[model samples]
Target chain A: MTRSFVLAGALTLALAATAACGGGEEPAAADGRGPITLTDTQSHEEASRKIIDAWNAAHPDEKVTLDIQPKDADSQRQRLINNAQTKSDAMDVIMLDAVWTAEFAANRWVDELPADMVKADELLAPTLETAKYRGKLYAMPWLTGTGLLYYRKDLVEKPPTTWAEMKETCEEVLPKQEGMSCYAGLLDKYEGLTVSFAEAVQSAGGTVVDDSGTPTLETDAAKAGLNFLVDGLKAGLIPEEGITFKEDEVKNALQSGKVLFARSWASLYGTANASDSPVAGKVDVAPIPGLNGPGSGVLGGANLAISAFSKNKATARDFLAFFTSREQTKTWATINSTPVAHTVLYDDPDLVAKYPYLPSLKEGIIKAKARPVAVKYGDVTAAIQNAVYPALTGETTPDQALSGLQQQLAGLLKQ
Target chain B: MRRGARWFAALMISPTLLVLALVVIYPLLSAARESMYVRGEGLDADGFVIEGERFVGLANYAGLVGERFVNAFANTTVFTLATVALETVLGVAMALVMHGVLRGRGLVRASILIPWAVPTAISGLMWRWVFQADGVANAIIGEKILWTTEGVQAKLAVIIADTWKTAPFVGLLVLAGLQIIPTMVYEAAKVDGASAWQTFWRITLPLVKPALVVAVLFRILDALAMFDLPFVMIGRGKFSVETLSALVWDEATQLRYGPAAAYGIVLVAYIAAIVFVFVRLLGADLLADARSRKGQA
Candidate 1:
């Protein structure tokens, strides 16, 4: 047994050595600069692929070769962390969920793009706030999102503009049909929590964290917004199963027609509007339902950043500029059917025809807001999820949960 | 001949030691080195020293002596202790039934391994679905289980998921040990008018003590490092069911490398202390001695 272990260990060491020298760090340079590896898997493949094709065409000499690897969100993040810790120069450019920009910048894992590539404020009003940490442009916003109320138009007379109207419709329809429930945003604790909580908060005129990034959800408006969710769960207007839902479930609920109306990102509009959708043309989207104020929603999207360890920062910058530019961002929206950060995509008749709500989505982009821009934002966002999820599930009282959130954020900010 | 055999043995052992050095020793040393630092800006980029990047000594350790640290330490302790206890008891009972006192041992053993043989990720997904509000388990029980809502239920979900994947592993190990227990001893005890309970206490347990210890130690180490099942089962909330592994994940993924490295050091210390205590209680030579003593006798 000991001998076998020794032999196995020796073999492993030899294998590792071979892995390191043979191909561990392949020459990623495309323009005689360096390589840029990006995780563009599953649904986002065509978007990145289209960009790569366009970049290669435009910068024929610079020849930016991007290695697009398949990875889930969590795994992609783990890879990012592992790359950072190891200081591997295998990847140059990165695609980050917009929220991770501050976390990455605060930790110093990524570099700001050349200032000329983007006008920090002109890109998107809400993202400008999230894009900074102690006053530094850490990431360039790529795409943007805010929740839209996806409802079956043929089944319902009109898209719900108020929370009460939606609630009444759900109360009437859910029990009348089997496996049919009004799917709201995911009640499961994740970024989905932020999306759903924001719908309610913005509807009730509450913000979890204020303009200066101070904790604010403990206020009365926030409590009432959360109470709206809790009341839905208790009334069985939204099923109890939502308490454990992630993004896919909300989509599944809408695509299957089991849900009368759901609040989800504009990104899911593509899926809902697809021909395969059970309720394809029957579906129409609006901003989140509101009671006291205008309908507003939480914004979530991806951002592009240049990894600091990259030996090819110049090439990466050019590619980023092209990717987020007026022509390319518009082209990207036209081809991929996701919203465009460039306002040009909104008026493009082809895009508007394909997605009639391109105007609303574009408006949402211009107004997309983040939960908080605190250094401890992830922790604070997690506190919000923890507080709101239970209240929605009837496990924690709305007041109790929001108060806990207040205490948690106050403590984290102090830390 | 003896000298030549010893040289061959040492040569064989050297390869294993070299592999361990390359894989384990190298990473551990690097982690230790990385732990003694304070970094600013891009950790993977052109990270510079904000406070201290080198030789911070006990400051990193000092940071971990606070509430989150203590809570994580306590959570790991509770999770490990509870999981090990349950797995051991369940594994033994399961092994006994699978090994069988009568016919159809083959069928029993194969069927018993169904839960164990399934991949852990698959098992976690399976259990997660069952633990869902109106899932299979809920359908049978006729009540929604608020698994993710309540803290206690969340912990229960993690433990159930862990046990479904791990207990079979323990059962197989214990069963192998049980099979090795000379049947003659049990027969002799029976002939000498020993009750079944007495025979079990005297013969079955004492003989399998080494295996049982090994199983528990293996499980304890694993449970302490658990991340997937819990992370998959539920988001670790404000009243966290978050293990140290989850904390390390959340910190690292969220780009808190300096603090994450510090956390990594603390986790290493925690694991080391556990291994040290376990080895001391169970003895390093226990298994080797048990076999050698048997041979000599």
Candidate 2:
């Protein structure tokens, strides 16, 4: 009887421990004052640290701390999600990928910002839209990016404006260059693939998802966009190794003088022209090619949001506004060579001289479309990658891939 | 007196029991509970996602019949079997080489262990560069095999990297077993006119079985839960290289807690079942050896 009593006591203790490990209770809000932390990826660490150091020097009582996350986009998103799920007060401010704004806002992990938090009118319209969820502003657009076609001007005097022209150029140029491949982009099975696929569909006059968050992959334009990639691979226009190229790989291919034409972010312009680059003087940028003309780019970049569980929400809000102010944005743009969200910077004379690609980049960003807005965005992208990758690899036809994606997305969005 | 002794023993072990209960048992129970419910979906009037989980019984498990799950499950099984089989053969050969090298033995041992000492994630990145489209691997082969893309080559790349990293561990364990075999056994065989091959087949193989079994068993468990190497080297969502752990991670990161937990439980069941079969076949010998040692004492 005594032994049994001991066992029962142990069992009860275990049960209590299990109960305690359940979801945490809603935390009481803290006053908007004190030292707070900002969680961001290491990609912007240098600029972020400089900004934070200046802010901390000015505001002694409310000094900001920077928590650097991994440079990988997927890893950064997962870390932010984990912090929110635990309802921790660790992350006061978060740098969210523009695509994640909807998911974060819909889940209430981030607080909706006031309409007048920043001079929203100064921000580019396409980028400004990425900061909203259901008509309410949930984040402040910090940096913006769009895809550009990088070409070796010496090899090809004129950049192609249409998909057919790109193919014809590749046919004419690749045979002359012994070691050079025609084109490259992000074709790996990850988030980059999703972006590349979306650009293709949009360029072909199709939408991956409509305004109502419904799958719209079953269209002639969508097939045409997919065929551009599939046929390119089949015809050896895109080298077999292109299937493994991510953002870094694509940039490296162009900088290393392996590819004649490459599709990558605007940031590649600065790096490709760096002094040590092999193709430094030979490189030039153009708008992404399309079925009929210059295609649209998918908007890519990060935004700043106030974590809902933060104790110093007021400080967080103030810091965000300070971070995105005209002066700070200029500092970030010049130092990091990053494309800022401010519209005026694109046309500034001195800034334009330093970065000549800004005009074309601004044009691409203006025409760029935001990725599909869904609360289950993680699942949605996975489904797209799952469907589109096989098609690119020759395992499935474009028709099958799109239909499969349509059915999978229908089930996901139905809930 | 016996009753007093029993109570004292229980008291002595209760702290360890409590710690285990808090860490292991608690998580297992929590995950089981989590698997039985689904998170509320869709947005509310204010565009915020609806909160709270609703109980759905085995619906999460039922959802595992999808193609992605099946592909992940198959990949996990194939990776475990292929890796374990290759590691055993390669590890044994390495052990023999390490055991026989009289010159520069220390150097040989340390160099062999370097791969195992490198962290899995770091080594994964190192190998990724080696397997790049224009990397050293292709340069040597003179064929541009895209090792990182979705194909049989991707699977082979992961297997080759995993074997290279972990075969040293198996070799180390086997070397310890090799050292423990008495010189007298070999002397006795020599006196009886045994060939080197005959002595090895008859004596060395039997003497090393226990350590070999334990090493293979550990490797089996480790391989069954493989994640880092494939994820870092080949990336996620690749149909050719996705494992069960990657699938669970993909789901959890996507905020589908219920399905992730269900996959976790399924993986646990899979590992447990394999271990049970393994012990039934080979672990019986280990227990018998332990029993004989105790009897001798």
Candidate 3:
């Protein structure tokens, strides 16, 4: 009897194993003419729906279904990767964060797009650069943005173009105002910190990684950039709470009339100028301050990529082209107040008249640099956050932070 | 006849055993197999990164000796011990209060269970706002403290949030234990001139040992796998609050599935070892109860 029971157990185990490994049928391929799903985050759900509606109207035969993913970038990326890894044809087109292009392309989860899919010359240089993995184009640039210096125009005579001027203005003007802090940016220990750190390094005339994708954080320019933030925090020019500020917090700080300067995205312009905002009509935008002059900001935006496992790759590619087209991009920018990849729209007379910050935002985006393009970008960004967070919180000096970061990046990128 | 009965019993339980094997054993075995292989790294001849797995038996396990893994291990252990211990004491007190309250008993019980009812992620967000630098927590203390930033403060914030959310769960379980105790035992102790504290120690405690053991066991298991509380309360990758689950999640999300599965196996082994020790030591009564039930059957 016991032998029979053991035999039965073994039989069940074998059956279960077979059941587990049995689901590997290849997805059937399809031509470009069919219904396809677009998996994107809900941040721009309204605008995305409008764009999809426009596409569906223009081409009734090739219908597109909008599948809204999570609003959080990390969750959205995980969902896309999970779907691709499972070889699911659920998502034909995906909206990828600019930083995820390298990871998706390296893993062959995203199909490489043709170079002529979009007008490469008309798109901003930094935005176009984010779409490429190695030398091949993997995604098409969508909405793009950069960090802009938001300052209270009513309080300061003019926006500061240098870190020294910003500090001097903070020291002079801060004491006179009640409950006011100096400057705030995305300094929390997350992806935003990495972006801000890269911006700082680049603004001080140093790059996080060189052309060969090697760590170059040991330079004096990197040190000066790190010191810009470290010294600001130490001297109370950047408020103590700024160490914990993210994008929303920094934007709130400026809009509530609590901060003299805030380094945030261009979308904050619309909100800061809203009639309900306390600082409405009092705030103005400028290029982010640097050691000497206007500093470069880290490029921030999303891209459209066709999933490698998708059955309807043709339809996906066509939809990407349609969505990132100049006309749709302008509509997206106006409706969502998103910074567009089309460079000419930044200087469009009508757009500039409607949004005054577009000119300064264009300058920031023009000088912006993409974060390091690495196959293991997840590890790279985590290392940056780990290495830089301590310095911002007064646990380490700027010199130590940069050197430590150099070592961390070197180990991470050694491959 | 006896053999026939045994066969019938086996046949009756076969479906349950089959389901268990498919769901539990299968995934565990799959994760074990995955842990032995590492994904190919770097680019291939075509400039695309090499795809597919390469067999590197035990290398992923050995690679867990890094500082990040050690820190996560330490954080996980500390959070489990701290949160479980605090929750036990507070939960017991709440259960006692709930048992004794004659007036507004429903109100008291419901209020106590409210925190437990709210979803953990929601509570994490609510506590985040409260723990903000200029938030109500600082307003109450009248001193600016960066609770969300790195260091011990962030760890404390996580522990506090976890304890607040789960203590009521323990209370609910223990209250069930309290309700089952017969009033006759307390009366007998009273008749023997026992003090209130002495009665509680001798009668109430021993009678509730089985229920308490089960509750603590469940708590220990749950706390060891704590993820959402810390992940939501304190942001991810913060050195202060990273746990084993978070480490696994981080690795998996970064497409390092091999290392992630290895971490998962290590975490499972760690939990199993702790549970075994706990059952052998403090959970003797739990086993005794099971044995008695089987003997009766």
Candidate 4:
């Protein structure tokens, strides 16, 4: 029934494309209700507003507001979900994990981008695919991240380029440096384990699943990458203490200069290079290592979407476009250390001076890859983490452990 | 006039039924309907299967009966039963001491309730910190126990955190039960030449049995639906502490509404049946004994 009305509206719009807007005593107020407001859950809400304010100064007609609820990921998601379900339209824009965009798009819980908001081809080529369902965009890819190897430049002359090299380097350097472990493998039974594991697998040119989304961890290439994690646990190159580690734990280790190399999202740069960090002067970040293959990393990023249940579509889309604009992108990256997805942001000279590592880190952004962008992506990730975490902490063999996980995810997807 | 007052009494009780319908009844019905339907792409599974959702009959339940599902379910069942049993036993003992012939009763009672008053999430995080390599527990153990690393340790960590957070609640309940026992019953038992153990068995035990059973059963039911401690400690991704609640939350978050709803429905049934059976079978004799004693009182 809704589809017929939509089709009829589409037909009418096609006939009168330019004259679709109607002005009357009761309706159709212009100037888009005095610009748009987009709510973000990113930590850099103030910086975003400052940047948007500057843009508005140049173009005041395009006023946009950003609301950042930075503290809780779950509350943000639940608020967005409840709002959408209730048709409250509480948020004009939603900042969502990159993995979520596909699910959002699939549920039709979000609206497709307007014809002019963004060019499909012009967006981050690989990353844009994550925001689409059935080849239609529901979200705009904004900032992005991939696992990078953060090492101490003052302590280590050369960083490791492979799993083997990383272990050897850690053994050589960790003994001399009092607090440092060789590698900060997130042995912590958390989501980050899967994130790091995916990076290792993809860096080796391995597929976690086939096109149909079947898990096949019994593969030889899969274990080659899996062994790196298991071997690290056995060698004590990574700490047993790391099994209790979360993102904050590893971040604290890196910030305290207690770990030689840390595998983390590049977003860590903001915190690692901050004045509060003990190793701020010493840390440098590079790509995750590969063994006899081109390096790869799992994408850590988010996108902005207009909730389908939102009452205000124009405002949400405006916020989506405005925040994603190359100008604001540079401002966010410069101030907060969030890597801008827009390739052109790398050219900003002021941002470069603020973050000298931006140029070095661009390689990771250029090569950033996403996990399987399915509605079941979350389930797959959960299962994979469940499988890999045990092996990571030496609870089970890489084969026996992953064999179960491989079976589980495949079984789940099939169901 | 009296009949009108009885009618007014019924009207007053209706609010609770209205609340029950709104909160518990509606969600359960919707969830049950949602479980029967399969989610395809787009809005394929929106309303009831008859209305919009296509019913898949028992596929959802059958699918969840697999290895991962069974593993999580068995783990949850074992964890809940074990934790509930341990906490209740410990809580009852602690409560008896608080109400028993003991020194510093007020201080002990006050200190014991402190753990229960702490928020589950905060207490869970605190326990996580305590179990960390450099944290208090590891320091006490004199070895860096990887609390969040292994399945065994992770479960133990959750059990510890949960017991810390909830045992006080059980203790308070049992303590209330202990207070209800008449002083005359103990005096009579002493006059009968009863020892301390015999007094406890003959007088105190029977008197508090109902409250103790009620507390234990209540805790058992609550522990069945456990989420926070496990989630905070091991997280959802690691099935090391993945209980039914986390699994359902995970499925819902992932947009696997069918499986989530399916698991949710099954979990509700499991918890309700378990609680009901526990009270009906376990509480019957205790309830009868308490009632006869109350009649005597």
Best by lDDT: 2
Q: Write the per-residue lDDT of candidate 3 for residues A1-415, one digit (tens) a residue.
A: 6765776677778889888887878867665567899887777888888999999998798899999998788888889988987888888888888998988898888888888887888999889999998888999998789999999989999899998899889889988999898899999888999999999989998899988879999999999988888888888878899988998789888877779999998888888899898888999999999988889999999898998888878878888888989988787767787787999999988788888999899889999999998878888999899889999877888888888889989887766
A109-227 per-residue lDDT for model 2 (tens digits): 99989999868779898899888888899999888989999999988989999988988888898888887888999998888888999999999988888888788889998899898
lDDT of 4 by residue, B7-30 (tens): 565556555555555566667867
Worst 10 residues of 4 chain A by lDDT: A23-32
Clashing pairs for model 3 are none
Local accuracy of candidate 3 as per-residue lDDT tens digits, B1-297: 387787786777777778888988999999999999988577876657787789999998985899989999999999999999999889888999999999999999999999999998999999998999889989998999999988899999998889999999989988999999999988888899999899878987788777777878888899888888777777888878899999999989877889999999999999999999999988877678689997997
Fnat of candidate 3, please? 0.65
Q: Which candidate should be chosen as best, given DockQ against the real structure?
A: 3
**Candidate 4 collision pairs:** B49-B53
Can you write out model 1's per-residue Cα lDDT over B1-297, one digit (the tens) per residue?
A: 365675576666775667676778666766676666655432222322243345666566675877877777777788888888888988998888986658888888887778878876677777877887657877887887767665678777777778777888789899988999888998899899999889878898888878888888889889888877776666555345788887777766655565677788778788889888888878565667888987985
Off by over 4 Å in 3: A1-4, A27-31, B293-297
lDDT of 3 at B26: 92
DockQ of each: 0.19, 0.55, 0.66, 0.20
Query: Which regions in candidate 2 have their CA more than 4 angstroms from the true location?
Result: A1-23, B289-297
Q: What lDDT would each prediction earn against the true structure?
A: 0.71, 0.89, 0.88, 0.72
- Share of real contacts kept by model 4? 0.30
Pick by TM-score: which candidate is best?
3
By TM-score, the better pick of 1 and 2 is 2
Candidate 3 chain A lDDT trough over 10 residues, lowest sum: A24-33
TM-score of each: 0.81, 0.96, 0.97, 0.83
